[model samples]
Structure formats: structure tokens, C-alpha cells
Target chain A: MQALVIAAHGSHLNPDASDPTYAHADTVRETGAFDEVREAFWKEEPHFREVIRTLESDEVFVVPLFISEGYFTEQVIPRELRLEEWDPEKWDSDGTDASQATLEATDVGKTIHYCGPVGTHDAMTDVIVQRAESVTEDPNVGEGVGLAVVGHGTERNENSAKAVEYHTERIREQDRFDEVEALFMDEEPEVDDVTEFFESEDVVVVPLFIADGYHTQEDIPEDMGLTEDYRLGWNVPADVDGHRIWYAGAVGTEDLMADVILERAADAGADLGDAIERVRAATAAGTGDEPRSEPEPGAGAGD
Target chain B: MSESTSDLEALLAAADDGVAFDGLRLEHEGDGYALETPDIERTGLDEGALRDALETVPAYVSNWQYWQREIRGDGTARRAFLRRCERAPLADDESADHQPVADDVALSVPERYDALANGIDREWGQLCITVRFVDVENPDGERVYDLWHVDDAGNDLADLEVYDDPRDARALATEDEDGRYRPLKTAPTLRSGWAFTGLSGQELVDAVEFFYPATVANWHRELHGELDVDHWLETAERQTGIYDVIDELPREAVDWMAEACCVDSQCLRRREWQYEEGDDLEVDGGDGAFPCREPCSLVVAAARKWTVLESEEERTYELELTTSELNQLTDLIDAVAEGRTDEVREADVYDGANRYRARYLRAKRFDEDGNLEATERDGE
Candidate 1:
């Protein structure tokens, strides 16, 4: 049996940090592409250390649902998952090749294929462009508007900025928008500088982060001087210094992310052929179970 | 084969005609086995199919089988606790003693299980377990559960934040409603207004673990007679860094530590570890569903501070106090120790812990520097 595991950075203080990962897992499960789909977190229960033990499948494919290929994807994830031993001194150091898409290892008689994070996927350029375009109903949303891709860049790891720059360069090459610039939360050209970086009267800032948590929902918007009141998701275009700014939600929450995750799994050479055959055989035998359903009670509606 | 598997095989054998066990009914039908539950029934099942069916009969079996085998073995505290949540058949008079939070004893087995769709809420520590079916209308469907803070049990799912991932429950457990960080996740101060809805059996157990780490596992171990409790002395000896000084704490001080941190109001876990091996503390270990295997880090940290304070030589200072004032001091200590300081109303001046009463005492007895007037440490 084949299983898909999405590894993410879950927050001990923010309930919404793992929302996109669970949503993507649910979407993947609906497709019946893998025998099982589970999510593991770095900071939460069923953590990387124990997620492998929870799976009954012989073949496990793990995809990091992060927006970068830095400390987490290269080091912490692998070490925590027991694919590599964590050297305490090496915590602050880096040596793993950032370009490697998949790392295959064998642990406890299971073939573990650790796929690259969804953030650095080539298709993310399209996700970012789609987020920017879908932020407003205005037909000329992308026309004459400068697009700023905001990432949670850090001075600790330069690779975090690389993924944002990659999408920025890719979008710039498309030449669909007037200008595409990359902004960071921690590094230079901060989110607060979005207005100064773009000379256009209208600018669309798309957060290149994973989930719509503190950074996307509060920090970035506050930095852009949009609203002090923290409301989730895309906001109405706010006027700042004669510039109309449209702040889109985090890119990872998009529906198309399910495709990107599958793409990354496939690119990692996860044996999808066997899973596809199993699903087909089950369907032919009329044994394919109905899609899992959740109870809808008179209580509260979930996000 | 494992004992449980053998027991299952025996159960299948005993079902040659018809037998009901743990809300499941099975019988022989034309060389095949027929299985039935209160909500759903299936016939024409061979041996393998019978086991598969037993593994998943929707209303109870499938949801119960995995967790029963994985997280809960027979006779485990967690198994008993989960059984209690589902209002599973009582084995003896002992189980009948602790009534369900929402008593449905009048309802039949099927009626009780069916009512799960509306959710039967039960409290475990600060967690509220809502046991309900995934699809009440579907016979072949399994049960799904939700875990929320007890305070959020009756709140609308819309009013409280809803979560499906077990990992997300950590955020709900890490702080109070006011957002003050809770150093002890097991403290009764678990923040309300968040629900982990629509969880499968394993997901429910996993979410509980996130909310109160190792609670289910420890409970399971305790029930299986495998809980290895490290007493206060051993736990203190194992401590390193600045915490190593905790081992020097006086024996009576350990009793105070247990009183302050291990009781039901302070922590949800019953203290299994004692002052030393088999030397139980004078204080009650609490009535929690799970057992704490050792003094938690908070206990150790607090013990370290207490150890240093205990090292100070005894100091005596005479102070005149009215009989009422002396009684008030006892009441104040009891209020603080029982964590009812906030519960005592400020307007109720008769209460010793009342804000105004406490302020008056401080003004009368405490010097300008806030030290007790006319008293000094012997060393000073």
C-alpha cells in the first residue's frame, strides 16, 4: 500500500497554521490516488518522529507543505522524521543540497520518499499569478498593476528568499503584469516598503507564505497600513498614499495546491502507478467506498 | 496469535446461532455469518468477511476496533474511559457508580448509539468529548467524535473555532481564553472556544494526546499494569542544570509540592508517583482519569524554588492579631491553594480572599515595602 504524508510547521499558538495542509490532504484523499493520506507536524502531535509509525503502508511519500527549501525542508524535517540523525551543532549550519527534489531512505522496512516542499514547485508561479488576479472582480486586475510577492524571509537562511525570487523572476518573464517585485517580512524590501517599491497607482501584494495565519492575516496587512482590525482572507483594496493596494490571501491556501502536491509527489518518483491500479481495481470490483462524509450538526460551522 | 485475536475467534465460534457482545450482534446465516448493529445489519459474510465486518460495522465496530487494538488494550483506563463516553454496556456494579454526564440509561443500546448523531457530550479533564455518528442516516457509516474545551461544549460550532487536524488542538491547549500562556497543558485552565470536529476514532485519541500530551498512552499503560512511576525523589535526582537542587527538598516539602501541583484543581492527571518509591504523599493524588507517571517539569521547577526557600533557617517574629484576623489568614491560604481566589467575589467582603478584604489586611499588616510589619529574617 502507498501513503502520502504532508509534513508542515504546525503552531502551538495558532489554530489555523495547519489548515491548508489538512485541506490539501482531504482533497488528495478524495482523489483516491493513495491508499492513505495523513498530515504530520513539526510542532504538533503525530509529529515527524511518530508519523511514520502511524502509517500501515509499506511505501510512504512525504511532501513538505512549506513555502521554502531552507532549514525545515533540508534539515529539521529529515532529522525529526529520523531520515537523518540530528547533530546539535549542525542546527545552525547548513550543508544539504537545496536543489534536491526528493530524498529516498529505508526505515523500519518502509520505503520513505521525502519530496520537496510545495513552495519551491515551478507551478507556484501560476498559483501566485492566479492569487493576484483572483483578488478582485475588476476585469483589469492585472493590467498596469505592480505585483509584490511577500515571503517570510530570514537572515538565518538565504534560501527562504530564493523561492520568492524564483516566483518573482518567473512571473516577470511572463510579462503579464507591469512589474513583479519580491518583498520579505524579515529581510530588506520589507512588506512596509511595498508602496515605495512600486511606482504604479495600483499594486497587488500576494503573500507567498503557506497558510493564512499571523503573517498573511495580520502582519503583512498591518505593514502595508491596510487595517488594524484583523480580518481573515483577502481584503477590499485599501488606499495608501494615493496607491490602491489589494492584499491577497496566502498562496498555499489555493485549491490548485492539491495539484501542486501531487505533482511534487509524482516528481519525487512516488510509485503512483500501483496506487492508480489499486484504485481502478477497487472501482471495477464495485468496492470503492463512498467518499468520507462529515456530520453537519446544529452546532457551529467549521472553517 | 494475540489474546484479543483469539478472543475474537472464540466470539465468532460462539456466534454459531446468535450472540450479542459490546453492542454488536452476530449469527450464522447459510454457512456465512450475519452481523448486525443497532443502526446497520449485514448478512452473507464468510470468515474473512466476518472479521472485516467486525472490524467495521459503522455504528460501533470499525471505529472501536482500530483504537481498541492500537491505542487501547483490554482493561486499559482509556478503553474504560472511551467505553464510558459511548455508554457501553456496564460490566459490573462498579462502572454503574459513576453516571454518564448526560445519563441515557433509559435509552436502549441502539437508542443510545443513535442519539450520538446529536452528540453525547462528556468531560475528561478540561476536554469535552462529543461522541456521535459520522452519518446518522447511513447504516454502514461509522462514528466520528469531536473534542473541545468543556466550557465550549454547548457553544455553537460557529461561535468557536473549528479544527479537523489533531495537531491544531495544541494551540487550543497552550493558552487560556485571555491568551495567557499556560506552562502546564494539563492545568484546568485549558482555553475554551475551539473544537476539533468530525474526528475518526484514532484522530480523537490523537487530538486528546495533543491537548494533554501522553494522557491516553499513560492511561493505557496504567490499566495494563505497565505504568512505571518515577517518584518525586527519583525524578528530582534525574534533573540537571539549575533543577538538580530540587533533590535536596525536605520530605514534607514534597507533600506540599503534591498538594500545590498534583491535585484535581491544579492538574488533571492523578499523581501516581509519590514522594519516594511506595511512600505516598499525605495529600490526595486526585481523581483524574489518567495517571501522571512522574513529577512533570513544572513540578520539578517549582520544587527547585521551594527547595531553596526551605534551605532558609526558621525565622520567628511575634505579631499581635485578632482571632478573626487569624481565622481570615487561614481562609485566605485555603482560597489561594484551592485556586478559588478569582471565584471569591470582591463585593462579598466576608470572604477572606475578597480583593478589598485582602487589601485591608495588606494595609494593616504589611509595611510600606510590602513586607510583613515588625518582622525580619533571622539571618538579616
Candidate 2:
């Protein structure tokens, strides 16, 4: 049986930050594809590992519901869950796979499949492009203006910045933007390069992040040199220098994300194989020295 | 004690008789008691004599009001949920302005309603009220016009005034064209000292009804003076009909061919505000033009500057302060700080700004002990 676990990087400081995680949890649950589905958080309650203990599933699929895959997916989630990294068999004993044990260190036997964060997914660019289209009165494809995919890049992980870089190239492929550039807070191809790389008179930048936190609020404006109003729902015009740009609210504001997770759950059903064993043993023996052992690790497996 | 009553009567007789003891009378009963006039009615008692006279009465101590003021230097502190109510019975004496048993506020649909009604209707655009002249005359001093408009939540919207003739009443209801209804401009111009007045209560109410657009019907008036109740009610009803007819007039059409401007209430207000603002001498972006009549501009400017709404909301507001008020806030603060106003500290209210916009006002006196003493605010 295959089960699914959704992990979110929530904030302890804001009660509103957990709203999306809880919303998506309900979304995935409505599908009923996995024998069981649960959520874990970087912050707030039902912690990342304890969530796994409660599920007790042998086969579990972990999905990162974050904007970037760099530090959190590559180092942070692995450090917390105690599981092996993807393509572990390919790595030689150069201390590469040695750190992979943290990804899977539970009393119960379990096989986990971790998916990329949703922001790194192909479908997300459509949402981003759709968001850009909503703001401008007319999106001139012929104009050589650049679409800068700005994400909250952190020094903590190389993998996180790759997601933004990949998404930027995919966006450029659509040709609405003649030039597509990826910028980061932690890594290079930075935001300062934007004005230098700006090809046309007009520009529209979208901040690819989970929530409108510090990076989106203070840092982005500082990077862009906006002194006045929070540039929401309004665009900047050229001759105004940086005024030739506008912003879309963080992608988490999309109302359809709840539907996306529900769809992903339906596509990920692997049917529980371990729960069958527990049920058969209970019928055959009828009585045992021990009662049911803390819902076997793969109890949520097999829809 | 019974002889003391007789003695009191004898005191009046002795005063009339010019006998000695100075208006004092004595009775044979009750061991020869003496009587005097009530202390309130004293005419000839010297200050010292009055004190001495007051001392003679044992336990004649009368209590007057006193205050237990608790002032903590720090003082930082809709509706429409009614279910049901029975209809009120008709008033026994509707014409009586002073309802004897009712709360004094019963006389208030604003006590200034009379002054406002007959004074002038300076409000513009959305606030067009009607004015109709009624024969109903006020008994107070000048036999002023008894004008009323709408009924406010509690009292009638009446504006009474001592007019020389019908012309003064006519001057009040004249339309102001250069005020709030200027659709071409996003920013509203400032206005002041403009009142929208009507000749009669119902006429003003009808004008208000036309601008506000409500289906109102019943009309009443409470005139204070020697008019009979029958005439008061009849006049109140007549005021209603005439005012409603006046409300039926349409807004004046704008003429593009001619450069001439017709002054409507809104344009008039803006024009008036512009004249007043000219005196500030420092409104050239240093303080940003105060949108005296434009709330949206005021609210937005405050919002952009303040982290919390209250900080800006507390900005001292000086609506149409005369040259005198401007002096009082700035010059008086300077004078008081320099100990120039120490003799009596006559009470006044003035809003102060932090070199920026005035946020709020502090009026009324605080004694050296910080007790609020009664203040006489002498102003026009």
C-alpha cells in the first residue's frame, strides 16, 4: 500500500502561515486514493516525524509543499525525517549516502517517494503566466521585455535555486517574455543584474514564494527600490525607471491550489500491501501475545 | 414652632412698617421667637451682615453641589439591532417647546436648528434641503422666522432667525454651485460658513428629502413663546407642504458655451474654502493642501503616513477656524507658556499639530489643581 504525507514550512510567528497547509491537507484527504493521508509541518503542530508515527504506513509518498526545493527539500526535510535521498544507489561511499540515513530511520519498515515542491512543478509556470496576464491591460508578446522570476533564494541549499532557474527557462519558452532571468537572495544571477539585463522598456516581476513574508514584503521592495505604496494590483510604467513593473501576490493566493493537491493524490494511489498482512494475521491467530502493534508502519498503505 | 410661623408673617409686617431690628419680627409664643426673610430674597444685607445672619440659624446648612474629580493624566479609551416596539401615543402638548417632565434634551433636534434653518443653507450637492416661507412667527425677541426642515433622530431640524424681511430667508436657500458636486475634479475643494436654510420647517425638510431622497411625511414643530397650541400645529403642517413643493425643483444645468459659472452649494463651498486657505500662507506642499471638505483625501493621507490608524486619526482638526481661533491655538499656547494668561486662564479649545497636521483639540480649563473649572468662552 502506498500512503502520502504532505509537508509544509509553516511559521510559528503567524497564525495565518499554517492556513495553506491545513487547506491543502483537507484537499488531499478529499481524494481518498491513499489508504491514509496526513500532514507534517516545519513549524506548528503534528510535527514532521510524529505525523509518520501516527500513520504507521510501510509505503509512504512524501510531497514538499514549498516554493523552493533548495535547502528545505535537499537538507532540511532529510535532516528531520531520517530517510535516504533519491538515487542513493548511484552515489559511491564518499559520505554522500552516509547522510541519507536520516531520511529513513523508523522502527517500522517503510519505502518513501519524495516529490519536488509544487513551485518546481511544470504546471506552476502556467499559474505564474496567468497571474502576469491578469495585471497588465495588454501583454505584448513582441516586446522584448524580461520576466524576472524572483524567488526567496537562501544560502542554505543549492537545490532550492535550481527550481527557480528551471522554471525561468520554461517561462521563456512560452515567448511572452523575450528574456527570462532568474534572481535570488542567497545565490547569483541576483536581482541587481535585473536592470542590467532588462531588455525592454517595460518589466513585470513575479515573486515565487509560499507566503508574503519578510522576503516578499521588505526585501523585494528594497531590491527594486520602491519607496511608496505596496505595489499590489497596480503596474509600473516605463520612463519611471523601475516604475515599469508590477507584482502579483505570492502564488499561494491562487484559489485553485486546494484542487491541485487533490488531483495529485488521485494520481499517487499505490494500494496498501502491509495492511493486508495485519488483517490476515488478526483473523488467523484470533488471539496474540501482544495486541495490535502501534498501527504497523505501513498501515496507511494500499487504497 | 407654631409661633415661629406667626413670627415669620410678623417679619413681613415689620419690614413694611419700618420698625427697628431691620425687618425682624417677634412673637409672644415659643419664648419670644424672632423671624427673618428667606436668605435667597435678601436685598439689603451687607456681606458681613449676611454672614452673621447665616450664622444665627442653627443647622440652617443648605447643601450645594461639589465635584469629586478623579483625573488620571492618561485617558486612552453601530447599532440597528432593534426587534419590536409599540407605536407611541400622540403627545398631549406637542406644541410646547419645553416638555416639563421630559429630559431637557427633548428640546434638541439640535438647539441650533433654528439658527441653522434661517441662517443660510451653505451645504452643497448631496445635501440640498428645501426652504418655504411660512407666516408662523416666533415670540422670542425679533419675532424671527420659525423655519424647520427634517426631523433629526430626536428633534426637528429647525432653523429660526430674526430676519429683517423675506429677503434674508431667500439669501439662505440660494444654491451654491462651486461646492462638492463638481464632478470634474477628483479632489474636493474646501468650504466654510455656508449654511443651507429654509423659510419653514417642512420646506427645509423637503429640500433635505430631495437631496437625500427619502419618502418622509409627518411634520411637527415645538415653538417657544406665547403662540396657542392650535396655531403651532397648523403652522407646522403648512411648513411641511411648502417645503415639499420647494424640493421639487431640479438641479441647474451647466452651460458650456458661456464661460460664466453658476454658483451651486458645492462650488460655493469650494470657493469659500479656497479663500480661507489663501490666508494660511504656507499651503504650498509643505503641509499638503488640507482637503477640508474631502474626507477620502484626508483619510487616505492619514493612512499613508500612519502605522496605526489611531495615530493619524488623532490629528488635530481645524475645520473653519476664524483668524481668532488660529491665533488662539498658536499665540495662546505661546502666551500661556510665557505665563501671559496666568491671571484667570480663561478656558478655550484648540487642536495642536506636531509641526505637521493638527490631530485633536483640548478645550476647557484645568485648574492648577487640575480640576475642570467652569469656563466662559466669549466668541462670536
Candidate 3:
């Protein structure tokens, strides 16, 4: 039997980090695509170290429910999951030139296909565009609306910014939105100075994050002048400097993420088999062939 | 018949007599065997169908198969501990008279299984366990379990913080009822008002590990004779850095240290380690559910300080104290050791450990530098 393991960076302080992972696993489980759909987390129980042993399936597809291909995806996860024994120190000097291809390993009758992080998938461009469009009152985002794809970048891993930059450039190529800018929470073109980089009065900020924990709920909103009180929920078209900052939920929380995770698994050579048809049938049955609306930011947006 | 088949038939016959084997009931009715669990009931089942039902229902299968094959014999301690957690009937002749004690309600087999649908609450240390049988009709179904702080067991899910990730249990386990940070995760002071709901078997075990790290593994090891216990002497010898001095502590002082730190009041793990190999300390190791295989990091750190204090040469000093004051000191030590210092009332002056009594003793005996007026250490 085939099993799908959605590995994520959960949080001891915040349960919201692993929420979306569970939701996606539940969605996948409903499809009867895999005999078992399990979730593993770096900071949560059923940890990466022991998660694989809990499954009964021999063929397992592990999809990292992360936003980028950086430290965790390359080093910490691979080591903890026993996917490989790589020196973490070499991760930086080795540079981003390391193969971004999926890593597969067979041990003790189980074959684990480690797929790429869902955030870097090509289909995420559509997810982000859909998210940006779903939030704003403006029917056409191209008519003067500026889009800022926000990522939590760090100097520790230069590749962290690449995913956001890649998707930002990809969206820019479509030339659908009036302007597209890649913003970072940690690095240059900070999300805090978002209005300074965009001239459009209507700016849609979509956090390129896997979960809506501290960053999406507090940091990004606070930085964008969305809320001063540091609250839990946010209303759209938040006024900042007399301009509308239409803040969408973290892009990873989008329902299409179920599709994206499956796509990533498929790209990793996991035979979708009848799961592809099941996903289509589920999509048709649930959403009725319409584009998904913007999701509310909070829990179940896997951290 | 094969031994396994005979055992299955024996189990079936036991169930037929209305014996509920950990919430599973199989009865030989007028037609065929009627197999039932908390979640599903398959009626008109022949011997093969009954076997199929038993093997398919995870709650039943995991309980019986694991119990019969592993827990019934000279099984691992972890398996035995798990049996205790489920309130399963004792398998050995040593406890032959002991049976699973149910409530006063003498419900029928079907009614009994139905009663378990809401979950059977059990306590493991400070954790409240709720074992739930989810969709047992499905062959690949699971025996989902939820873990909450024992204090939060009665709280509604809506009123309490609901968590799905087991890792989040660390945060809940980090503090006490009064919000003070508990340095020891297994200090019997795990904060309440949080629950990890709908966890799989592995997730349940993982969450328990986060709350009380290595308790399950260590307990299993100790039971299987695989536990490598580092006693006080050996553990102290291995210590380096500032803790290297811990080896200098007197053997009797080590006993006091165990008394101060390893008991049930201070830690929820039974102290399995002693002063040295085949050498037991005079102090009573706690009766905690799990065993402490070695001195924890906290114990080692505390032992270093204790070693330094113990190294000081003993000195005699004359002191003036009333009989009441002398008794109050003993009361104060007892109160502090039992974590009841807060319970001593200021108004209750008659009680030796009362706040006002303690203050009176301090006022009369303590010097300005917070030292006893008539006493000084040898160095001083």
C-alpha cells in the first residue's frame, strides 16, 4: 500500500503551524488515494525521526509542506528523517547548486520518495495569483493593483529568497498584475517598507508562507501597518497611509494546495495512478469547478 | 487446532459468556457469532467471519493481539505498563483474582461497548488519556486517542485549547497550574487547559514523550533488561566541566540528594538508579509509573552544588532557641519538601510552619546579613 507523509515544521508554542498539514492529509485521505495519509513535523509529535516507522505502507511519498528549499528542506529534515547523512556545514559552501531534484532512499522494505517543498512548485504561481485576485474588491488586479509576494528570508540561507523571487518573477512575466514585487521579512525589500516600493494605491500582500502562525497573524500585518493592537484576525483592504492594503492569507493555505502537494509527489515519480482521477472528482464535487476564494489566515495553514 | 486458533476460540468462548475483553464482545448467538466493539457490530458471523472482524477492528485487534502475544507472557515492561493503562485484566496467575473493574452500571455487552464510544479516560502521570475507537468497521481504521492535562479532562474542548500536533504538548507541559515555569517536565506540575485531540497511536506516544521525555522508552528498557542505568557513583564519575566535582559528594549526601529530588513529590519518575551497581541507597525511590534510568541533567547539576556544600568541614556553634522554634524548623523543612509552604497560613501562628511563626523565628534568629546570629560556617 502507498502512503503519503506530509512533513512540516510545527511549533510547540503555536499549534497553528501544523494545522494545514492535517487538513491536507485529511483531504488526501478522503480521496482514498493512499492507503494511509500521515503527517510528520519537526517541532511536533510523530516527529520526522519516528514518523516513517508508524506507517504500514511500503511505498511512502514524503512531501515537505514548507515554503522554501533552504536549511530545513536540505539539512535538518534529511538528517532527522534519515533520508541521508549530509554535513549541515557544507549546506552553505555547497551553495544552491546542489541538485533540487527529489531524493529517494530504500531501507528495511520501505522506499521513501522525498518530494520538493510545495512552495517552490510551478503551480504555486497560480495559487498566489488566485489568492491576490480573491482578496481585492477590484475585479481586475491588473488595473492599478500592485502585488507584493512576501517571504521570510534569512541571510543564513540565500536560497530562501529564491522561491519568492522566482514566483514573483513568474507572476511578473504573466504581466497580469500592474506590478509585482518580491518582499522579504528578514532580507532586503522588507515587507515592512512594502508601500515604499509600490506606487499603486491598491496593494495586495500575499505572504509566501506555509502557515499563518506568528508571521502571518502578527509580524507581516504589523509591519504592513495593518493593525496596531496585534490581534488574531484581520479585515481586508486595511487602510494604511490613506491607501488600501488588501492582505490575503498565507498562499499555502489555499485549497489548491492539496492539488499542489499531489503534483509535487507526482513530479517526484510517485505514480498518481487513480489518485489523479480521485482528485479531479473531489475538486468537481467540492468546489464545483470554480476558482477557490481567498482563505482566512490562521490555523491549518501548516507552519 | 493450532495454538493461536485455540487461544482465539478460548477468547471467543470467554466473550460468549458476556466477558468484555477491553471493550470487545463476541457472543455465540442462535445463528452465528455476533462480534462487537465500541464502534462496529457484525452480526451473524461464522468462526471465519468472527476472526475477520477481530482482525479488522483495530481497537480489538491491537488490544487482543498485542496482549495475547506480547503482554500475556514474560513480555516487556512497556507492554505490561500499557495493559495497566487500559485497565485490562491481569494475564498472570499472580493477579488471577484481579479483573477489570467497571462502574456500578451493569450494562449489557452491546451497551458496554456503546459506553466506551465516548472514550475511556485514564491517567498517566499528569496526562489524562482518552482512548477512542474511530470507525472500527473499516479494516484500516485506527484506535484514535486524545491526551489532555489531567486537570483539563473535565473542561470542554471549546473552552480549552485544542491541539492536533503532539509537539504543542511541550508548551502545555512547560508550565504549572500557577503559570510558573516547571524546569522538570515530569514534575507532576504539567499545566492544564490544553488537549491534543484525535491523535493516532504513534502521535499519542510521541506527545507523551514530549511531556515526559524518554519515560516510555526507559520504562520499556528497564522491563526488557536492556536499560543501562547510570547510578550516582558512575554518573558522577562521568561528569566533566563544572559538574566533575559531583563525584566528591559523600555517599550519604547522595542519599539526601535522591530524597530531595527523586521522590514522587519532586519528580514523577521512579528512581531506578542507585549509588552504584548492586548498591542501593537508603532513600526510598518513588512509586511513579515510569522509572528514572539515571540521574537527570537537573539532578546532576543540583548534585554538583550539593557536593561543594558538603565538602565544607563541619563546625559546631552555640545557638539559643526555644523548643517551639526548634520544632518550627522541622515543620518548615517538611512544608517546603511537600510543596505546601504556600498552604501555611499567616494567621495560624499555632502551626510551626505558619507564615507569621516563620517570620517570628527569622526576626529572632537571623542576623542582618540573613545568617543565623550565633552560627558561622568553618570558612567564615
Candidate 4:
């Protein structure tokens, strides 16, 4: 069956980064729709490279949880995974079985196809809007309240902050916010530099970053002075900035991340199969490059 | 599918010795081992030493008394306090068995900081610092403020916040949906303050002292955590010759500060609080001049500590400071320039951060007319 790999910008030192991937993988596994599902991270274990060769399903789908279409998604994961290119230019215009045959001949799985990162999807706007709504009790999200859509913007790449453009645009189209603006931890529209841009004293700072660190703790508070009282801690368990300012945890820490992976698999055209035959095929052929004794059925496949 | 981190933590606790996470050999699976963190390293040890080290933790975590009460009186006395520590010193026989953290000690702050700060000095990579403001009510007869500081610059840290106010403080969550911040809310009535307890080296102390007590405390700390320590100096029990909490003390005392200051107490004014976001320099090195090579955002080196002090009479403000050793070197430089090297012996007494610094004679060279040219930098 189709297996979904939720790739993330994970950290080993801090558990918060990769935990979302693990948590969503658990939820996706519980659905039992996919024969296999797993997580891979840039910074932590089950790294991007080894995780790909370990997948057994005929059709494998990868969905990056990164918030930007920057270098990581465009260059790093592709080079490391050895994934076949998805450019349609090499294909016959008639949409025939030619490419499939070419892939099969080249020893690339005919069923293997990759979709873009889930972060780039239009559906993610809904997730952001929902997250904003979830922070407030009422569905009324930030009426006259300044919603600072905080992104980990960097001067190293303008495109790093450009994702905020897409997010802010999509979020605005949904008509869910009273005032929505973009702020960065590093780049222009720098969070601290333009806190008044939101125009509302009641500002909700949402980290579009995968995991929280200095920006959330020092930069955000030092600029806003919202948490001058929360000394010794940059992060205060989702609540410490006071009601005048609300902060949503990093966007990847959501339950619906698994849904995004499933959507990516559908886009990649995953081949679903009965559990019995798939398990038998995976065990007999040996899913890993080197053959190993069979696992005790479903043991450790999801990790 | 079954791998939950909490489940892993529970298993780590239950196992007799080190156990692989999710029963997968990490090295074979191609990821370096992920089951350890130096912060919780003590949890991995045998029972007895683990228990003894852990016993000090709850108290350390729950209050700031250990930090602010660091017994800063006589020089030899301070050394004795440090040698003794807070909890009983690890028995000499048990010293070898003490594995203080949960992971390999390589992840320890000092070790990591050494590696990272070395890189910074060598101009390798940028550094990041995580500053946390931890305020816990030590209802065990004291109220103290603590700042938990971590950085890429190795284990050189500073977690020093003392509540001069005699009031107890605790964590509270107030949620207002319409407000900007969420579940972790402070009472609009909550007022407290915090200060930087440590600096990079003794060189940075004077600048910190000048900036914080002047700029940040007036604007922030007086509105947030501890009232000014200067407030109770003369009026506090130490000055009144009162060894009592209730009898002769002023009405607004929150908790007794164990140390007595021999300074005059004065009435500190409470300013009207305002926080509309200020204009910016796009700090955090956004210039691409010095970019972060890693995917993570590189942070600057600074300790960010805050405290919330609530009061019936006094107001709280925020305090933020950074410093460096003022120029004590030129005296020695002048000593050499004049060729009278024997005067170098006098320069040794200028210990700025060490609580004693000698006032060096100011240097003023005469212009065409012999007069005070204001060319000398004063020493405190």
C-alpha cells in the first residue's frame, strides 16, 4: 500500500522539532490506510537518506513539513534521497505508458512519484487559519486584534521570508482575520522592528518556524515587552505573553500534519494493496538494501 | 507506529540499564544514538547517586533561593559557601558514581559552550543563546528570582535574580481569548522585576551596572517583577535594627531578603506602563553580512531574564543590561609608557567585578595652557 513519509526540519537536541512528525505518523498509522508510514528529519535520527531505502511499499510518497520551498526542499532532500526527477518535459505529450516503462527499465520503481512539500499546499492556509481560530475561544479570529504571522525570515535568502507572502495572501483570502501582517525573526519586516505594523496592541505572534528557540523567547519578548515578566524562560508553555499577545506554537506541531502527508500521497498516485500481500512481499524481498531476518510482523515499521 | 516519546521516556525509566529506543539499534538504522540528553542525564544512573543528585533538583527547580542566597559577604566565607554548595557535597566515596545528567556529558552546557564559543572566537559559526526567566515561589520561607541561561558560548552562565521585595511569587495562567497572548497569562495586577546575575567576563560588569539600574529598571522591571532593591535598603529590617518579619518592618514587605544592604532606602516612582512596538534595526544579523550557515537561526550572545512583582504599594519594572570591563588597562599602559614599570603593582588592585576596584589617578596632559583638559577616564 501507499506509504507516506513526513519529512521535517527536526532537531535532536530539542524534542519539540521532530516530535510533531512522530506524533502525526502515529495518527496516520492508526488510520491503517497506508501499509507503511514513517518520519524523517534533517537534524535528528531516521535521517532523510536511510529512511528512503527502508520503505517497502511499491508507491512511496514524501511530504516535507518545512514552511518554505527554499534550499532544503529544492536541493537537500532530493540529492540525499536519490529521488527521480518529476519534470514532465521528458515525457511524451500523449500522456502514455512510455515514462513508466522508462522508469521500470532504469530500475526506478514505476509506482514511485513525489509530490511537493505539504507546506507549499493551498490546504495549509486552512491549517493556519484554524490554528489562529483555535487560540481564541470564539471562531472570531482577531477582529481588530493584530495577527502577527511570524516567520523565521533570514537575510541569507529573501525567498525564506517570501513564504510569508504566500501564507499571508492565502490567509487573507479566507477572510478570517481582522488584521494580518508578516514579521520575521531575522529578515526585513523584522518582528521587533515593526511591531506597530499590526496596528493593534493585542497582537498574536505565530511562529511559522518548525520549532521554537531564541526568536520566540528573546527577540519576540525583547521587542514586544509582552513577557518582560517571564524571565529565565523564552518559551512559556503557550501562555505567558499575557492576553494582550498570543503565540501559537510552531506550525508543524499539528495533528492534521498526517492528513497533509496523505494528500501528498494521493497527488503522487500511491498504490494501495491488501495488508497481507504487501507484508508478505516486503518480508520476502527484504525491504532494506541488505537482507535481514523478518521483523515480528509490524514491529518498528512506522519509526 | 507505536513510537511515542513519552512511551520512550517511560521505557527509559523502567529499563535496568541503557535500552535502545523503540528497540531499534540506532547505529544500524543510520542515525546517531538519540536516547540521551545531558539535562536529564542523572536519570540514567544507578539508584543511590541518582537519588542524591535528584533530591537537590526539585528544590533548585522550584525556587531561586539557592542562586540569590549565594552568601556574598566575606571573601573566604563566599569560598566556603561554594565549596559546601547547597545540598550536601557528593560524598568523597560517592564522587565517581555521580553521573549528573541524563545524556552523555558532552551535551552539558559548559562542554557545548566551550566548543561553540571556541568556534565563535575562531570566526567559524555564529552563536545562539536561549534565555529563560524562571520565577518560582519558595514558600519554604523565602522568595527569590532565577534566570536560566543557555548558549552556544559554553557553560558560562548567569542565573541571578533576587527578590528584594518580601512577597511570595508563583506561576499563574490567565487566559483571555480576545487578548494577544494565550493560556499562560499574568494577572494584570502582577508586578515584578529581574536582573542579569552574570556577564561574559569581569570586563562586562560596569556597563551592565550602569545600563540596567538606569534604563531597563525604570521602564520594565518596576512594572513587572521585583521592586527596586534600592527601595528597601534603608527602610528594610536590616537598617531598622529589627530582626523581625512582622513587628517593626514596613507594611509592603513581600519576603525577607537574607542579605542586608547598608544603603539608604528611598521611595521609587512607578511610571505609566506602555508597550507599543518600537521602530527597528532588524537586529539578529539580518544583513547577510554574517549569515547563519545552519538551517537554524543563529542568535546573539545576551542573557534575557525577567520577573513579575505584584505589590500593594510599590510598582514593578523590567531590567535588561549588557556590560564590559571599563578601561583599567591604560593605567598599566601608562605605567609602561612612562617607563616606571614598578607602578604596575598598583594596577593589580583594580578588580572591577571582584567587588573591589581602586580609583586610579586620571591622566590629563596639558595643552598649550596647563589646565584640566578632561582627557581622563574616571575609575570607580
Candidate that would win on TM-score: 1
The candidate, 2 or 3, that scores higher on TM-score is 3
Ranking by DockQ: 1, 3, 4, 2
Ranking by lDDT: 1, 3, 2, 4
Better of 2 and 4 by TM-score: 4
A1-303 per-residue lDDT for model 3 (tens digits): 788889887765554666678767767766677776777776564566556655556778888888777767776677656665344443332332222343444222367777667887777787787677667634346668899999888766676788888889989998887889999998888988888888889889999988887778888898888888567555698888867899987887766578778877777676666554454344322323333332322222221
lDDT string, candidate 2, B61-132, tens digits = 110000001111111000000000001111221333453231112211122224323432222232323321
Q: Taking the tens digit of each residue's C-alpha lDDT, what string does model 3 give over B88-110? A: 43342233343323212243333
Per-candidate Cα RMSD to the true structure, in Å, reads 11.6, 32.0, 11.4, 25.9
Candidate 2 per-residue lDDT, tens place, A102-138, comes to: 1344423466655556665555665566455544534
How do the candidates score on chain B by TM-score? 0.71, 0.17, 0.70, 0.16
For model 3 chain B, where is the 10-residue window of minimal lDDT?
A: B100-109
Give the chain B TM-score achieved by candidate 1.
Answer: 0.71
lDDT of 1 at B189: 88
Which pairs clash (backbone N, Cα, C closer than 3 Å) in model 1?
A: A300-B157, A300-B158
lDDT of model 1 at position A190: 91
Give lDDT: candidate 2, residue B211: 23
Evaluate all candidate structures by whole-model CA lDDT and list the values in order. Answer: 0.70, 0.40, 0.69, 0.39
On lDDT, the leading prediction is 1
Better of 1 and 4 by lDDT: 1
